[model samples]
Target: MSVFMVERDLKGISMDDLAGAQKAAIKTAAQMSDKGDKISYIRSTFAPEDGRCMCLFDGESAEQVQRLNDEAGLPYNRVVTALDLTP
Candidate 1:
């Protein structure tokens, strides 16, 4: 599996929306696992000022991550493969 970043643009997003999206992502991850696929939601970075977000995930491919987002009804602008660089 590889890491991916899903980008989204949401203006004036409420806390409730973020919480709901997070929960849906978790459920989608579990569903993927049940299907024998490895996909997980790592975390999300929100930029309220910019009305944008970057959601981190680990999955087989960018497509898989996109699929999960779609299944969960999560709104995203794009999905890109990511390289984790930890200090």
Candidate 2:
């Protein structure tokens, strides 16, 4: 699996809505995995001051990651291949 980053510009979005989006991503990913699509939500980062959000996922391709966001009804600026340099 490869890491993908989903970038979003969600200015003025409320906390409740942000949490709901996160839940949706997680649930949608699990459902996709159950149906044989290998995808998983890794983590998310948000800059509330500007409402800039980035979500990370593990999947086969950037298209797969984009599809996951679309299925979850999440808004993203782009999905791109990423390096998970987390320590």
Best candidate, TM-score: 2
Worst 10 residues of 1 by lDDT: 78-87
Cα lDDT tens digits, model 2, 24-51, are 9999999999999999999999999999
In model 2, which runs have C-alpha deviations exceeding 4 angstroms?
none
What lDDT tens digits, residue by residue, belong to model 1 across residues 1-87? 899999999888898998898899999999998999988889888988988998899999999999999999999999999876655
| Model 2 TM-score on a 0 to 1 scale | 0.98
Clash count, one per candidate: 0, 0
For model 1 the local lDDT of residue 48 reads 88
RMSD of each: 1.0, 0.5
**Clashing pairs for predicted structure model 1, backbone only:** none
